[model samples]
Target: MPQQNMGDFTLYFLAFDHGQNYQAMSPEERNKERFTREGVLELTHNHGTESDPSFAGYASGNSDPGRGFGHIAITVDNVEESCARFESLGVKFKKRPQDGRMRDIAFILDPDGYWIEIVPNKLKL
Candidate 1:
């Protein structure tokens, strides 16, 4: 049997308060395929092709009007620097930058109370 091409589909939409959510979500200079500007944020994963089930990417919005557990993550060149920048802009973080079991990380809540995980880009792979 020929291998089936099972591409990754849109799994879920996250929520954030600021418009820079896309920048925070993408960071690392990746291309953003689309931006609805009407509460829709789309992203693409560098790995895992559309033919791979493990290939995953998602969209984010400004509202979390649904009852479900969901969150978004982004890898930064420096967690502290990123946190500082966001903080200077009056953004709130749920958990300050600290040492995690696997990596140094932090958490910030969106307008809908979803946790946004920020970690070092070195720990992404």
Candidate 2:
């Protein structure tokens, strides 16, 4: 698995594409298709070196949004800019930054309908 060093924390992102036609596509095609999907580019971080490349697996099985699991949170450098970029990419939003009382954050849905909360790098009380 590839690793990303973020200050004191090390994070790893393991992505799995379970599209209905995933098994029909070649590895290279799968890689190319992954980037063409909405919200993928924004969610993916730096792929590790060749020795330990980022793992992107494909499966024919479908993925239903998990129950009892809350949304995943991502901290970005700028909330407004990030939201704008996400919107431009046609990512579905559960809650826009200015939609509710909590105007500082936003919620976006992944291809699998999983909610992802976007926050600022620094939280202001």
Candidate 3:
């Protein structure tokens, strides 16, 4: 369990690997036919696919730092309000919204220097 009593807090979405038994794949195995974004989206939804406009990458260390697969998407009730609070607290986001999909996206580093993406979900149409 996470330690109780917090000064500041943040939560992000986690996508689970469906247990294809990655250990079975030897280091020598190459990805000649890895799943594409559309193929992944068509099958299920969770991890950032190649086609997701809102996808953002983080730099987590690995033997091959580029090989780690995971991203955390924080949910915000009101993104603008959250931004104002963050600004007041002097936490400048490393990245800000650019496209329509990122209408309310922001980023801040965790205590361990991990990039956590703050994402505000769109209101249902």
Candidate 4:
């Protein structure tokens, strides 16, 4: 996969495909039915070079929530600003920074319906 440097963070879109069943779902369907079917699995927070690094990854065929597969997190310089930019560009958000109990984090869906969590580079906690 190629790594894209998005100013504050780097993004790596993996080449792994979940298969035919997963590929059949539209982005909107993926958003509405997240984790309910097999789909693209993404991992973030790279601490080292691609050849020598530490990270976590997962993709599941089971729809059970207990499987523990969740969205990937990306650290950014400014959560609010980045979110506002995303909004202006018509990005769909699963959860905004001001919407839930966890106010500091935001979840935005990628074109493929995978949730990408946006977080502050520095945690308030």
- Which candidate achieves the best TM-score against the true structure? 4
Q: Give residue 109's error in model 1 in angstroms.
A: 1.2
* C-alpha lDDT of residue 125 in model 3: 25
Off by over 4 Å in 3: 1-65, 98-101, 123-125
Q: Where does model 4 exceed 4 Å of error?
A: 1-63, 123-125
The digit string of per-residue lDDT tens for model 2 on 65-106 reads 443455678878888999999989999998999998999899
Score residue 125 of candidate 4 by CA lDDT: 29
Candidate 1: segments with Cα more than 4 A from true spot: 1-67, 99-103, 123-125
- Per residue, candidate 1 scores C-alpha lDDT tens digits across 65-124 of 354446668878898899989899888777887645544799887654657888788743
lDDT of 3 by residue, 1-125 (tens): 11112234322313233444434664333122133211221112334345578666444642245567444556677777877787788775656565356666877655445566777756532
* lDDT at 67, model 4: 65
Please provide, for model 4 over 77-100, each residue's C-alpha lDDT reduced to its tens digit, 9 standing for 90 to 100. 889999999999999998999997
TM-score for each model:
0.43, 0.47, 0.40, 0.48
Q: Indicate the residue-level lDDT of 101 in model 3.
A: 62
Shift in Å, residue 5, candidate 1: 28
- Of 1 and 3, the candidate ahead on lDDT is 1
Global Cα RMSD, each model: 15.0, 15.6, 15.6, 17.7
Query: Candidates' lDDT values, in order?
Result: 0.58, 0.66, 0.49, 0.66
Worst 10 residues of 4 by lDDT: 54-63
